[model samples]
Target chain A: MKSWLTTTDHKRIALLYLGTMTLFFTLGGLVATVIRVELATAASDLVTADTYNRLFTLHGVIMVFFFLIPSIPTFLGNYLLPLMLGAPDLAFPRLNLASWYVFVAGGLLTLTAMVAGGLDTGWTFYTPYSTTFSDSHVILAVLGVFLAGLSSVFTGINFIVTTHRLRAPGLAWLRLPLFVWSLYATSLILVLATPVLAMTLLLVAIERGLHVGIFDPEAGGSPLLFQHFFWFYSHPAVYIMILPGMGVISELVPCFSRNRPFGYGFVAASSLAIAVFGFLVWGHHMFVAGQSYFASVVFSFLSFAVAVPSGVKVFSWLGTMHRGSIWLTTPMIYALGFIALFTIGGGTGLALAMLAVDVHLHDTYFVVAHFHTIMVGGMLMAYLGGLHFWWPKISGRLYSERWGRIAAYTLFIGFLLTFLPQFVLGTQGLPRRTASYPPEFQFLQGLSSAGATILAVGYVLPGVYLLASLVRGRPAGDNPWGATGLEWCTSSPPPPHNFVRPPVVTDDPYDYPRAPQPTITGVGDA
Target chain B: MPEAVREPFADPAHQRDAVALGMWAFLGQEVLFFGVLFVFYTSLRVRHPELFAAFAPRLDWRLATVMTVALLISSFTMALAVRFAFTRARRSLVLALSTTMILGAAFLALKGWEYAHHFEHGETPQIDLAGLGRGPGLATFFGVYFVLTGFHALHVLGGLGALGWLAVAAWRTPASDLRGSPVMAVGLYWHFVDIVWLFLFPALYLAGRLAP
Candidate 1:
C-alpha cells in the first residue's frame, strides 16, 4: 500500500486518480439524491433553504471540480498517454505523483469547509454574493478550488510535454489516434484557462478577506468583470470536462463500428476548433447578467459558430457507423447514447445562445436541464463507455458483458427520465436554485426524483460488477477488444515500464487489419 | 552525463531537449496566468483612467525601478549560470546561481519594503489613500496592486528556492550531470518569473503616471 502511495509509475498514478475520483463521484451523487428528494415535494420539507443551497452547491462543486474535470484525462489519459505515444512514462514522473497528492489535499480542504460550515454560493461563485453577501466558508472553498486548479496545471504541463516530445518515430501527426488529439487539445485549454480561474478565485478570496471593493458594487467594482474572468476560464472549462469524453468516444466509436472515423482530419481538427472557439463564447453566459447588447450579439454568434465543429464531430461519428460491422456492445451503447444526448444538449445550448431565448431561459431550469444533458448524459455516458472499453487493457480482466449492457441501457433510460422533465419544468418558467416550486410543477419534479433513484442504481451496478471482475473475471489477453493502438501492442496490465521493449510504430493508428504489429525493440536494444 | 539521460530517452541530448520543451510549455501557461491579470488591469484602467492616475502617484517608482534592476540582473545571472552549466564549469555555475539568488532576494526585500510603506500610509486594499476618497475605484486600484504584486512575489520566492537547489546540486554533483537539463529548466522558470515582472513593473508603476 505504501508502495502504491509513493510509486511514480504513470499507471499507478492513474489508478490513484481513478479511486479518488470515484469516491468524489459517489459523494456528489449522494448529494444530488438529497437534492432530488427535497424537490420531490412542493415545499422545503426535506431540508431548510440553507441546507438545500449548500447541498446543491456542494453537488456542483464536487461533480465539476473533483469528478468530471479529472474523470477521463487524469485517469485514462495518464494511463494511456504513454502507452499510446509509445513512451515509457510521462516527462516528469515524480511530478505526476505530486499532482495526485495535491489533488487529494485540495479535496480534503474543501471537505473541511463542508464540515466546518457550508459554502452557499453556487459553484459559479458569482461575485458580490460570494464576495460580500454570503456568510459561509467561502474562503476555504475558493482556496480548495484554487489548489485543484494547480493540480490541473501540472497535469496539463505533463500531457503537453509528453505529447510533443515523446511520440514514437513513425507515429506522425496524422497517424496519431483521435484520443491523443483530443487530449492534446484538452490540455491546451487546461493549461491556458485554469490559471485565470485560479487568479479570479484569489481575487474573490482577497475581496472577502480584506473587505476590498474588487467585486462588490458599493466599491465601484464591476461585477461583470468577475463574470468575464470567471467565464473566461470556466467556459473553456466546460470543454475541459467534455473534450476528453469526446476523445474517449473517438476511440470507442471506431473500435465498435469496425471502421475508422469517417473524416479523421476533420474529427481531430474539431477538438482544437472546440477548444479555440470555446474561449470566445463565454460572454453568452453573461448576456442576461447585464453585459452590453452588442457583446451579447457577438457572443451569441460565436456560440452558434462553435456548434459547427461539434456538429462536425457528431456527423463524423455517424459516418463511421455507416456500412460498418457495428457491434452493439456496452461501450457502443453508451457511445450511441452520448451522440443522441449530446446533440440534444448542444441543440438546447444553441437556443440558450440566442439572445432572445436566453433572456427567457436564463436562470431557469432550462439552463440546468441543458447542461445536465451535456455533462451527465453526454460526458458521463462517454466516461462509462471508455471505462468499459478499456477495462481489459487496464485490469487485464473481463467484466460481465451482459451486466455491462444492462447498466448502460438502464443508465440511458434513467438519465432521460431524470433530465427530460426538467426541460418541461424549465419551459414552464420554473426558476433554478429554488427550494420550493408551485404545486403544478411537483408532478414533473417527482418524476425527476424517481428517475434519480433509478439512475443511482444504474451507477452502482457497474461499481459492483467491475470490482467483482477484478477478482473472478476471466484473464483478458493484451488486446481484448481487438482495438488498434500502441496500447494494445503490449501485454495486459502492462509492465512497470509499460513496454517490455521500446515499441517502434510502423503503421498508421486504428488500422484494423492491414497495420503491422509494432516492432518491440528489446530492452537495451534501442 | 549518463545519469542525466533518465529512462525513456535514449540519449542525454534528447533528455535535455525534452526537459527544455516541457519547461517552455509550462512557461506558456505561465504567460496566460499573468495575461489574465493584465487583461483585468487594463480593463479597469480603461474604465477609470482618472482614478488609476490618482493611485499611480502613490507608488514610489524609484523603489520599483531599483527592484526592476535587481530582477533584470537576476535574469542575467540565471542566464550566465545556464551558460556555465554548458561548459561544465562547476565553480562558475555555483557562483552565477548564488548571485541570481541574492539579486532575487534583493528584489523581494525592496518589494517587502514597498508593501510596508503602503501599509504605514494606510494605502491598503481595504483603505483608501490619505487624500484620495474612500471610493471603490481607489480601493480597487490598490486591490489590483496588492494582488498582482503579491502573486508575482510568490513566484519570485519559488524561483529563489529553485535557484538555491540548483546551486547546491552544482556544487556537489560530478561534472557530467551538472552540465545538463536541470540547470536549463530552472533557468527557463527564472526567466519567466522575470518576464512577468517586466510586464508588472510598467503596468503597475509606470502606467497613468502624469508626465513630470
Candidate 2:
C-alpha cells in the first residue's frame, strides 16, 4: 500500500485520481443537496445568505474543477490510454504520478479555503466583486485553481505525447479508436486553454492580494476584460469536460451495437472541430455583460457553429445502432440516455446562442438547466457508462448486470426530472444564484428538489453495488464485452506492462466482423 | 556504444523522439500561458495610451537590452550543449551547459536589479509609483510589467536548473550513461524561454514607448 503511494505507474496514478475525484464528487454533491433543500421552499429559511453563497460556490468549484474536468481525462484516460494503445505506460509515467499529487495538493488547498472561510464569488470569479468586494478566501481559492490548472497542463502534455509516440505499429491515424481521437482532441484543448485560465486566475489573485487594479473598476481597469479572459479559457474548458465523455460513448456505442461506427472519420474529425470552435464562442457568455453587439453576433454564430460538430457525433452514434444487433447492456443504456439528454441540452444551447433569446436567458435558470443537462446528463452518464464498460478490465470482476441497468435508467429519469423543471422555471423568469424566489416558482423548485433526491439515490446505488461487486463478484474474462480495442486484447486487470506480447494493430478499431468467435452474450451471462 | 532503451519505449531512438515531442508540446502550452498576459497588456495599453506614454520613460530599457543579449547568449550555449551531447563530447557538453547556466544567471541578476530599481523608485505593483498617479492605468502597466517579467524570470530560473542538471550529468557520467535526448530537451526549453523573453522585452519595454 505504501508502495502505491510512491508508484509512478499510470494505472496507480489513475486509481489515485479516481479515489480523490470520488471524494470531491461526494463533497460537491452534498453541497448541491444543501442548495436544493434550501430551494425546496420559496424562501431562505434553511441557511443564511452567506452560507448559501458559500455552498453554491463550493459546489461549483469542486464539481467543475476537481471532479468534471479531470473525471474522464485524468482517471479513465490515464487508466486506459496506454492499454488501448498497447504500450507499457504513458511516455512520462513520473509526470503522470506528479500530476495526481498536484491535483490533490490543489484540492487540499481549496478544501482548506473552504474550511477556513469559503469563497462566495462563484466559480467564474467575475472581477470587481471577486477582487474588491468578496470578503472570502478568494486568493487561496484562486491559487488552488491555479495549481489544478498546472496538473491539467501536465496531464495534457503526457496524453498528447503518449498518443503521438506510443501507438502500436499499424494503428494508423485513420485506424485509431474514436476514444483515442477524442482524448487527443481533449488534450489539445487542455494544453492550449488551461494555461490561459492559470494566468487569468493569477491576475485575479494579484489584484485581490496586492490591491493592484487589473480588473477592479475603481482601479480604472475594465471588469469586462476579466470576463474575456475567464470565458476565453472557460468556453474551451466546456469541451475539455465533455469531449472525453463523448469519446467513451463512441467506444461503448460500437461495442454494444455490434457494428462499426457509422462514420468514424466524421465523428473523430468533429471532436477536433469542437475543440477548435469551442475557443471562439466565449463571448456569448458576455452578451448581456456589455460586450459589443458585433462581437456578440460573431460569437453567437460561432457558438452555433461549434454545435454542428456535436450534432455530427450524435448522428454518427445513432447511425451506429441502426440495423445492428444492439445489446442493451448497462453501458449501452447510459450511452443511449446520453444521446437523448445531450440532444435536449444541446438544443437548448442553440436556443441560448441566439443573441435575442440569450438576453432573456443569460443568467436565468434556463442557462443553468441547459448546462446541467449537458454536464450531468451528458458527461456524467458517459462517465458511468465508461466506468461500467471498463470495470471488468479494470478490476478483473463482474458486477451485477441487473443492478447496473437499474441504476442507469434511474439516473437518466432522475436527471431529467431534476433539470427539466428548471428550464420551465427559467422561462417563467426565475433568475439563478438566488436563495429565494417568487412563490409562483415554488412548485417547479419543489419538483427539482424532489428529483434531486431521486438523483442522489441513483448516484449512490452504483457506489454500493460497485463496491459490493469488488468483494463478491465473479471473475471476468478479458473481452467480456467483445470489445475490439487493444485494451481488450490483454487480460482482465492487465499486468504491470499491459501486454504480454507487444500488440501489432493489423486491422482498424471496432472491427467486430473480423473478431474471432463473436459471442454476443447477454448481460446476465458472465 | 548503443544505449539501452528505457522502460515503456521500444528503442533508444523512440525514447528520444517521445521526450523531444513531449517537450515541444509543453513549450506550446507555455506559449499560451504567457500569451494571455500579452493579450491583457495589449488591451490595457490600447485603453490607456496617455498613461502608458507617461510611464514608458520610467522603464530601464538599457538594462533590459543587456538582459536580452545575455538570454540570447545563453540560448546559443544551450544549442552548443545539445550539439556536444550528440557528438559524445562530454567535456564540451559540460562547458557549454555551464556557460548557458552562467548566462541565464546573469539575465536573472539583471532582472533582479531592475526590479530593485523599480522598488526604490516606488514603481512597484502594489502601490502607485512616484511619476505615475493614483489612476489604475499606470499602476496596471507596472502590474502587468511585474507579472510578465516575473513569470519570464521564473522560466529562466527553471531553465538554469535544467542546465545545471545537464552540466552535472555531463561532467560526472560516462558517455554511455549520458542521454543526448535529455540534453536536447533541456536545450529546447532553454531556447523557448529565450524566445519568450524576446517577446517580453519589446512588449513590456518597447510597447509603452510607441503608445500615443
Candidate 3:
C-alpha cells in the first residue's frame, strides 16, 4: 500500500486502479445479487421498497461510474499507452499518479456515503427528487461522482497528448495501431463530455444546499433542461465506456485470426465517428421524457447517422475473418461474442430511436436489457478478452487456457439468459426498478434471477483462475502470440523504461506473414 | 547522414513545439468545459430574458469591472514575463510573473467581497427575492448567474493557488531550461481564464439594455 502511494510509475498506477476497481466491482455485484434476490420472490419480501431503491441505485452507481467507465481505460490504457506510443512514460507522470489518488478519494467518499445510509438518487441524480426528495447522502455521493469526472478528464488529457507527441521515430500516424486510435477517440470524448457532467452535478449540489433554481420547474427552470445537460455528457459517456473495449476487440480478432485487420483506415475512422455522433444522440434518450419535438427529430437522425460507422466496423471485422485461418482461442471466442452482442445492443438502440417504439420501451426492462447487452455483453466481454490476450504481455505469466475458455463460454451463455427475458418482460409492459411486480411477469423474472446466478458464476471463474495463475502459471516470453506491435518487442513484463533500446518501426503494424515464425520471443535490443 | 550535422537547435525547438501544440489541445478542452456553462446560461437567458436582466443589476458591476481590469493587467504582465524569460532575462521575468500572481489573488479577494455583499443584501436567488420580483423567470435568472459566476470564481481561486506554487518554484529552482516554458504554459491557462470572465462580465453584469 505504501509503495502504491509513493510510486510514480504508470504500471503501478494501473495496479492501484486494478486493486481498487476490483473491490468496487465485487461490492457492486453484491448489490446486484440483492436486487435479483428481492425480485425473485415476486413480492417485496426480502427488502422494503426504499431499500430496494437504494440497492438498485448503488448498483447503477457502482457499476456505471466505478466499474464500467474505468474498466478498460484506467487499467489497460494506463498500462499499455506509453508502451504503444513508444514513450518512457505517459507525458505527465505526476498528473497520471494524481488521477489515481483522485480516483481513490472519490471511491472512499462514495463508500462513506453508502455506509452512512446510502444515496438513493441512482447514478443520474435527476433533479427535484435529488434536490428535495432523497433521504440519503445525496451531496456526498454527487461529490464523489464530481471527483471521478475530474479524474477522468485528467486521464483524457494525458492520453491525448501522449499519443500526439510521443510516437517512436518511425512509428508515423498511419502506422499507429487501432487500439491507440480508439483510446485517442475515447480520450477526446472523455475530455469533452465529462466536464458537462461535472457542472450538471455541481448544479444539483448547489440546488440541494443553497436553494439554487437550475432544474426546479417551480422556479421556472425546466427539468427537461437538466435531462438535456445530463444526457449530453452521458450519452457520449457510453461511447467512452465502450470505445476502448471495441479497440481491444479490434486488436484481438486480427491477431488470433492470423490476418491483418481488413480496412484498417475504416476501423480507425469509425472510432472518431462514434465519438462525434455520440454527442448528437443524447436527446434520443429523452424522446419519451418530453424533449422538444425538433430536438427529438435531430437526435433521431443523429442516432441513425451514428449507426453507419458502427455497422462499418462490424462488416470490417467480418471481412477480416472471411478468408483468415481463424483460431478459436479464448480471446477470439470472446471477440466473436462481442461482435454478436454489440450488434444486438446496437440494433436495439436503433429500435429505441423510433420515438413511437421508445414511448412504449422507456423505463421498461427492454431499455435495461439493451444497455446491459452493450455494456456487459459487449464491453465486459471485450475487456475480459483483452485481459486474457494481454495477460502474457502485462504479467509475464500465463493464465490457464482451459478455465479461460470455460469462463468465456459461460459468460456468453449467462449474459444471454440474464437479459433475453428482460426484453420479453419489457415488451409486455413491465417497468424497471420496481421492488414488486404483478404476477403476470413472474415467469420472466424467475428466468432472469436464475440467469443472474449463472452470470455470477461466470464472473467469478476468471477471478479464481487469474489469481491462481499469478502464483503458479508458466512464464510468458515476449511476443507469445506472435503479434506485431512495439509492445511485443520488449520483455513480457517490460522494464522501468519500457524498452532497453528504442524500436524503429519499418513495416505496417500486425504484418504477420512477413514476420518471423514462433513470434520474436525476446526483446530486440534489450 | 552525419549525426553531428543534425542541427543542434532543431531538436529542442521541435520538443517545445510539441509541448505548445499539446497545451493548446488541452486549452481546447478547457473551452468546452467553460462552454458547457455558457451554453446553459444562453439557453436559460432565451427562456427568460427579462428576469435575467432584472437579476443582472444586482450583481455588483463595480466588482466585476475591477476584476476584469486586474485580469487584463495580469495578462500583460504574463506576456512580458514570458517574453523576458524566453529571452533569458531571469530576474525581471520572475518579478513580472509574481506581479501576475498577486493581481490574480486580488481579483479573487474582490470576488469574495462581492459574494458577501450579495449574501448580506438577501439578493441570493432563492433567499431574498420578494422585493426583487415574483416571477419564476427571475428565479431562473438568479440560478444561472450563481452557477456561472460561482463556477468561474472557483476556477479563479484554483488558478491563484497554482500560480502561487509556480511562483515559489520559480524563486527556488535555477532559472534554467523548462523554467520559462512552464511559466509560459501556465500563463496561457491564466489568460484563458480571464478570457472566460471577459465574456462573463458583459453576459452577467452588463446583460440588460441599460442607459450607457
Candidate 4:
C-alpha cells in the first residue's frame, strides 16, 4: 500500500488509478440508484426537487470526470503503452506518479465539494445558473474538475510522447496494434479538449466569485457563449470516453475471433477520423438552443461526417468476425453486446444529427438513452470486457469464467431493459431531468428502475469475483490468452521496469495464424 | 522471450524523442485552448458589434498595450536564454533567464493592478454595459473578455513562477553542463505562454479598434 502511494512505476500508478476509479464508479452508481428510485414513481416521492437535481449532477460529474474519462486510457492504456512500445517506462515516470497524485487531489477536492453542500448545477453548468444563480459550491466543484483537467493534459502529453518516441526497433507505425492507434487518437482529443474545459470552468469560477458576469444572462452575458465554450470541449470529450473503448474493442474482437483485425488500417484511421471530426460537430448539441443557422448547418453536416467513420469501424469489427474461429468467452459476450448496443446508440446519435429530429429529441429521454447506450452500454461493456480479458495480466490470476459469463449476459440484458424504454418515453414527449413526469410515462420508468436494479447486481458481481480471484484463483502465466501484443510478451504483473531487457517487436499485433508464438514454457499455465 | 530481449537503445535518444514529441503535443493543445476563446470572442463580437465596441473604449487600453509590450520583450529574453543554454553559455543563460523571469513578473503585477482598478470603479462589463441592448448582451461581452483575459493572466503568473524556478536552478548548476537540458523544456513552456499573450493582445485589446 505504501509502495502504491509513492511508487513512480507506471504499472503501479495504473493500479492506483484503477482502485480509486472503481470506488468512484460505485459512488456514482449509488447516485444513479437514487435517480432510478425517484423515477420509479410519477411523483417526486423519493427525494425533493433540489436533492434530485444534485443527485444527477453528482452522478454525471463523478461518472464523466472521475470514471469514464480515465477508465480505459489511464488504467489500461497506461499499463499497456510503455510495454507495447517496448520502453522501460513512460517518458517521465515521476510525472506519471505526479499525475496520479493530481488525480487524487482533484478527486478529494470534488468529494470535499460534495460533502460541503453539493453543487446543484448540472455537469454542463450552463451559464447564468452556475455563474449568477446557484448558491451552492459551484466554485469548489469547478475547481475540482479544473484540477482533474490538468491531470488529463499531462496524461495526454505522456501518451503522445511515448507513442512517438518509445516504439521498439522494428515496431513500425503500421505494425503497431490497432488498440495503440486508437489510444493515440484518443490522447489527441484529450490534449485538445481538456484545456478548453479548464479555461471555461475558470471563467465560471471568476463569474461566481468576482462578479465578472461571463455567463450571467441578466448581466449582458450570453449564456449561449458559455454553452459554446463548454460543448467545444465536452462534445470531443464523448469521443474521449469512447475512443479508448474502441481501442479495447479493437483488441477484444480480433483476439476472440483468432484473426488479424480485418481492415486494420481502416479501423486505425477511423479512430483518427473520429477525433478530427469530433471537434466540428459540437454545435449539434446547441441546435435547439438558438445557434445561427449557418452554425447549425455546419454542425449537422459534421455530425453526419463523424458518423461515416464510426460506421466504418462497425463494419471493420464485423468484418474481423467474418467466418473466423469465434470463441464465446465471457469477454466475447461483452464484445458482441457492445456491437449491438453501440449500434443502437450510434443510430440514435445519427437521428439527433438531423436538425428537425434534434429539435424534437433535444432534451428528451431519447437523448439520454442514446448517450447511455453508447457511453454506458457500449463503452462500459467494452471496459468490462477488457477488464475481464486483461484480468489475468493485471491481477496475475484468472477470474471464474462461469461467473464472468453470467455477469456479461446479465449486464447486457439489464442495460437494454433499462435504456430501451427511455427511448420510447423520449419519443412520447417525456423530457429528462424532471423529478416528476406525466403519469403515462410512469410504467416505462418503473420497468427502467427494475432494470437498473439488475444492472447494479451485474456490476457488483464482477467486483466480488475479481476480488475472489486475487486470493484463491490460480496464478496466470505470462501471455495468458496467447495474445500477440508486447504486453502479452511480458510477465502478467510485469516487473517494476516493465521489461527485463528491452523488447524488439518483429511482427504486427494480432497476426495469430502465421505469427510465431514465443516458445517460452511458463507462457499461460499456472 | 524475456531472455531474448536486449537493450532497446544505446543512449537516451528515446527519452529525447519522447520529450520533443510531448512538447509538440502540448503546444497543439495550447492552440486549441486559445482557439476556443478566439472562436467565442469572434462569434459574440460579430453578433453584438456595437456593444462589444462600446465597452472597448472604457477599458484601460494604455495599460493593456503596455503589458502586451512587456510580454513581447519577455519572450525575446526567454528565447535568448534558450539560445545561451544551447551554446553552453552558462553565465549568460542564467542572467538572461533571470531577466525574462523579472519581465514576466512585471507583466503579472500590472495585470493584477488593472484588475483591482476595474473592480474598484465597477467598470466591469457585466454591470456597466448600459450602452448595449440591456444588461444581458453587454454582460456577455464583459463576461467573455474577463474570463478569457483573466484566465490568460493566471497562465502569465504560472509562467513567472516556472521561469523563476528555472532561473534559480541555472544559478545553482551552471547551464553549460548536460544537466541543463531540462531547461529547454521549461523554455518551450515559457515561449508558449508568451505566444498565448500574443493572441490575447488582439482579441482583448483590439476588439473595438476596427469600428466603422
Candidate 5:
C-alpha cells in the first residue's frame, strides 16, 4: 500500500487512475440511472424538478470532467505509452503520478460541490447563469475543473515529450504504433486547448466568488464570449475524449483482423487533422444561443469540415477489416459496435451541424442522443474495448471470454435502445435537462429508462469478472493475443521499471502475420 | 551531490534536451493561458474605447515601469543562472538565482502598492459593475486589468517558489555534478513571466492612451 502511494512507476499510476476513474464512472453512471428513472414518467415521479436538474448536472460533471476526459489518456495511456515506446517509463513518472493525484483532488472537490447544494448550470457552466446568477456551488465546481485542466496539461506534456524523445533507437516516427499516433494527436489538443478551459474556469471562479463576474451582461460582458472560450477547449476536448479511443480501435482492428491497416497513414494523419480542425468549430454550439448569423454560418461549415477526418478514420477501419481474418472476440464486438454507433453518432452530429437542422434540434433530446451516440457510443465503447483488449496485459490475468462477449452485446443493445428514441423525441420537441415532460413523450421515456438499467448491468458485469480474474483467473503470459506492440514483448502486468531489458523496436507496429511467435489466444488456456 | 543524470535517458545531454523541449511546450501552454485574457481585453477595449482611455492613465505608469524593470532584470539573472548551471559554477548559479528571486519578490511588492493606490481611487477587488450599463464602463476596463495582472502575479508567485528551491539546490550541490535541466526549465519559465509582463506592460500601461 505504501509502495502504491509513493511509487512513480507508470504501471502503478495507471492502476491508480483506473481505480479512481472506475469509481467516478460508477458514480456518474448511478447519477445517470436516477436521471433516466425520473425521466421515465411525464411527471417528476422519482425526484423533484430541482433535484432532477441537480442529478443530470452531477451526471454530466462527473462523467465528462472526471471520467471521460481522463478515461483513456490517464488510465490506459499512462500504462501503455512507455511500454509501446520501448522506454522504461514515461518522460516524467513523478509528474505522471502528480497528474493522478491532482485529478483525484479535483474529483473530490467537485463531489463536495455536488454534496453541498449542487449547481444546476449543467457541466457547460454557461456564464451569466454560472458566474453572475445561479447561487449553486459554481466556485467549487469551477475550481475543480481548473485543477483537472492543469493535470491534463501536465499529462499531455509528459506524453508529447515521452513519445518524441523516448522512442527506442529503431522506433522511428513511421514505425510508431497507431495508438501512439492517436495519443500524440490527443496530447496536442490536451496541451494546447486545456489551458483555454483553465482560463475560462478561472474567470468563472473569480466572478462567482467575488461578485465581479466577467460574463455579467450588466457589465458589458458578452455571454457569447464566455461560450466561445468554454467551447474552444471543450470541443477539442470532445476530440480528446474520442481520439484515444480511435487509437485503441486502431490497435484492436488490425490485431483481430489479422491484417495491417489498409490506410494506416491516412488513419494516423486523421487524428492530427481532427485535433486541428476541432479548434475551429466551437461556435456551432452557439449558433442558436444569440450568435450572429454570419458567425454561425462559418461555425456550421467548420463543424462539417471537422467531420471529414473522423469519417476518414471510420472508413479506414472498415477498409482494414474488409477481407481480413475477422474474429468476433469481445473487444472486436465493441469495436464493431463503436463503428456502427459512432457512424450514427457522427452522422447525427453532422445533422446537428446544419444551420437549419440545429435550430430544430438544439438542446433537445436529439442533441443529447447525438452526442451520447458519439461519447457513450463512440468514446465509451472504444474505452471498454481497449480495457478488455488490454485487460490481460494490465492485470496479468485472463478474463472469461464468454462473459466478456455477454457484456459487449448487452451494452451495444442497451446503448442503442437508450439513445435512439431520444433522437426521435428530440425531433418531436422534448427539451433536455428536465424531469417533467409532456405526457406524449412518456412511452419513449420509459423505454429509455429501461435501457439505462440494461446498460448499467452491461457496465457492471465486467467489474465483477475482471476483479475475480485478478485472483483466480489464469496467468496471462507475455504477448497474450499474439499482438505486435513493444508492450507485448514485456511481462504481463510488467516489471517495476516496465521492461527487464529495454526493448528496441525492430519490427513494424501491428506487424501481425509476420510476428513469428505462435499465437496464444488467452482464450481456452484455462 | 545531486545526480548529474536521471532515469529513462541515455545520458545527461539527452535529458537536458528533453527537459528543455518540455519547458518550451509548457511555455506554449502558458501563452494560450495569457492569450485568452489578452483576447478578452482587446474585445472589451475595442467596444468601450473612451472608458479604457479614461481608465488606462489611472494606473501609475511610473510604478509599473519600476515593476517592469525589476522583472526584466530578474529574467536576465535567471538566464545567467541557467548558463551557470551548464558551466557548473555553483556559486555564480546561486548568486544569479537569488538575485532573480529577490527581483521577482520586489516586483510583487510594487504591484501590491499599485493595487493599494488603485484601491484608494475605488479600484477595489470587486468590480463596480454599475459602470458597465450606465456609466463610464471604467469598472469593465479595471476588471480586465485586474484579472490579467492578477493571473500574472500568481504565476510569478509560483515562479518564486520554484526559484527559491533552485537557490537552495544550487547551494547544496557540487558544481561539477549539478544538473542544468531543472535550472534551465525554471529559467525558461522565469523568462516567460518576464515576456508576459512585457505584453502586460504595454497592454495595461500604454496601449489604451487616447490619441492626443
Candidate 6:
C-alpha cells in the first residue's frame, strides 16, 4: 500500500487511476440507476425535485470529470504509451503520479461538496442561476473541478512531451500507432482547452464566492459570455473524452481484423483534425443561448464540418475490416459497438447542428441521449474493450474470455435498450433534467429503467472476473494477441523499465497478416 | 562532468529536450489560462466600449509602467540565469536568479500598494450598495481589474517559488549537479509570466489610457 502511494512508475500510476476511476464510475452509475428508476414512473417518487436536480448534477459531474475524461487516457494511455513508444515510462513519471493524486483529491473534494448538500446548477453551471441564485455548494464543487482540470493539464503536458521526445529511436511520426497518434492529439486538446475550463470555473467560483459579477449580467457582465467561455472548453472536452476511445478502436479494429488500418495517415490526421475543428464549433452549443444569429450560422456550419473527420475515421475503420481476417474477440466486439454508437451519436449531432433542429431539440432529452450515446455507448465501450485487450499485459492474467464476450454483448444491448427510447421521447419533446415527466412517456422511461439492470450486470460481471483472474486465471504469455506493436514485444506486466533496452522501430505500426495463425491464447483460456 | 540523466531518457541532451518541450507545453496551457481573462476582457470591451474608456483613466498607468519595467528586467535576468546554468557558472546563476526574484517581489510590492490605493479610493471588486447603485459597470470594471491582476500575482508568486527552489539548488549543489534544464524550465515559466504581464498591462492600463 505504501509502495503504491509512493511509486512513480507509470504502470502503477495507471492502475492507481484505474482503481479510483472505477470507483467513481460505480458511484456515477449508481446515481444513474436511481435516476432511471425514478423515471420508471412519471411521479418524482424515488427522489425529490430538488434532490433530483442535485442527483443528476452529481451524476454528470462524476461521470464526465472523474470517469470518462480520465478513463482511457489516464489508465490505458498511461500503461500503454510508454510501452508502445518503447520508453521505460512517461517523459515525466513523477508528474504523472502527481496528476493521479490531484485527480483523486479533486474527486474527494467534489464528493465532500455532495455530502455538504450538493450543487444544483447542472454540470454546465450557466450564469445568473449558478452565480446569483441556486443556493448550493457551488464554490466547493467548482474548486474541486478546477483542481481536476489542473491535473489534466499536467497529464497533457506529460503526454505531449513524451510523444515528442520519448519515442523509440526510429519511430517516426507517421509510423506511430494510431492509438499513440490519437493520444498525442488528445493531449493537445487537454493542454489547450482544459485550462480555459479551469479559468471559466474560477470565474464561476469567484462570482459565487466573492459575490462579484464577471458572469452576472445585472452587474454589466454578459451571462452569454459565461456560455461562450464554458463551451469553449467543454465542446473540446467531449473530444478529449472520445478521441482517446477512438484511439482504442483504431488499435482494436486493425489487430482484430488482422490488417493495418486502412488510410492510416488519414486516421492519424483525423484525430488532429478533430482537435482543430473542435475549437471552432463551441459556438454551436450557444445557438439557442441568445448568441447572435450570424455567429450561430457560422457555428452551425463548422459544427457540421467536425463530422467530416469523424466520418473519415469511421470509414477507415470499416475499410480496415472490409477484406481482412476477422476475430470475434471481446475487444473487437466493443470496438464494433463503439463504431455503431458513435456514428449514430455523431449523426444526431449533425442533425442538432442544424440551427432549426437545434432550436427545437436544445435542452431536451435528445441532447442528453446524443451525448450519452457518444459517451456511454461510444467512449465507455472502447475503454472496456481496451481494458480487456490490455488485461493480460496489465495483470499478467487472462480475464475469462467467455465472460468478457457475455459482458460486452450484455452491456451493448443494455445500452441500446436504455437510450434508444430517449431518442423517441426526446423528439416527442420531453425535456431533460426534470424529476417528473408526462405520463405518456412512462413506458419508454420504464423500458429505459429496465435496461439499467442489464447494464449493471454487464458492468459488474467483468469487475468480478477481471479481479478473480488476477488471482486464479491462466497466466498470459508475452504476446497473447500476436499483436505487432512494440508493447506486445515486452513481457506481460512489464518490468520497472518497460524494455531491457528501448526497442527501435523498423516498420509501420499495424503491420499484420491476412490469414494469421491463431494467437497463443484462445477462448475459455481462463 | 555533465548532470546525471533521469530514467526514461537515454542522455542529458535527450532529457534536456524533454524538459524544454514539457516547459513549452506547460506555457502553452498557461497562455490559455490567461487567455480566458483576456477573451472575457475583450468581450466586455465590445459590450461596454465607452464604459471601459470612461474607466480607463481611473487606473494608475504610471504605477503599472513601473511594474512592467521591473518584470521586463527580471525576464532579462532570468535569461542570463539560464545561460549561466548552462555554462556551469553557479555563482553567476544564483546572482542572476536572486536579481530576478527581487525584481519580481518589487513588482508585487508595488502591485499591493496599488491595490491599497484602489481600496482607499473605493475602486475595488467589493461593490457596496452605493457603488452598485451608482453604476454596476464601475464595480465590474474593478472586478475584472482585480481578477486579472490577482491571478497574475498568484502566478508571479508561483514563479517566485520555482525560482527560489532553483536558487537554493544552484547555491548548494555542485556545478555538475545543477542542471540547466530545471533552470531553463523555470526560466520559461518566468518569461511566460512576464509576457502575460506585457499583455495585461496594455489591456488593463493602456486600452483606456487616451480616453477623456
Best by DockQ: 6
**TM-score for all models, in order of appearance:** 0.96, 0.97, 0.95, 0.93, 0.98, 0.98
* Stronger candidate by DockQ (3 vs 5): 5
lDDT of 4 by residue, A1-526 (tens): 7877888778888889999999999999999999999999999998999988898999999999999998999998888888888887777677788888899888999999999989889888987888777878899999999889889999988888778777888999999888889899999999999989988887788777877655555654568988888998999999999998988888888887878898888888999999999988889999988989999998999899998889988998899899877777888889999999989999999999999988888899999999999999989999999999888888898788889899999999899899999999999889899899989888999999999999999999999999999999888888766677888877878887777878887766788786444332332321
CAPRI verdict on model 3? acceptable
What C-alpha lDDT, on a 0 to 100 scale, does residue A237 get in candidate 1?
93
Calculate DockQ per candidate and list them. 0.52, 0.58, 0.36, 0.45, 0.61, 0.70
What number of clashing residue pairs does each candidate have, in the order they appear? 1, 0, 0, 10, 0, 0
lDDT of 2 by residue, A317-407 (tens): 9999998778888999999999999999999999999999988887999999999999999999999999999998899988888899899
Interface CA RMSD, all predictions:
3.2, 2.9, 4.8, 3.8, 2.1, 1.8
Compared with the true structure, what per-residue lDDT tens digits does model 5 show for residues A249-349?
99999888878897888888998999999989999998888888999999999998988899898888899898887877888999999999989989999
Clashing pairs in 5: none
Which model scores highest in lDDT?
Answer: 6
Model 6's DockQ score: 0.70
Docking class of 4: acceptable
What stretches of model 4 exceed 4 Å from their correct place? Answer: A515-526, B1-13, B51-69, B112-122, B125-148, B174-176, B202-212
Give the distance in Å from residue A299's predicted Cα in candidate 4 to where it truly belongs.
1.9
**Pairwise lDDT winner, candidates 1 and 4:** 1
Provide the lowest-lDDT 10-residue window in model 2 chain A.
A517-526
Off by over 4 Å in 2: A516-526, B1-4, B128-134, B208-212
Candidate 1 stretches greater than 4 Å from native: A513-526, B1-3, B128-134
Q: What C-alpha lDDT values do all the predictions have? A: 0.88, 0.88, 0.83, 0.83, 0.88, 0.90
* Model 2 whole-model lDDT (C-alpha atoms): 0.88
Provide the lDDT at A519 for model 5.
Answer: 48
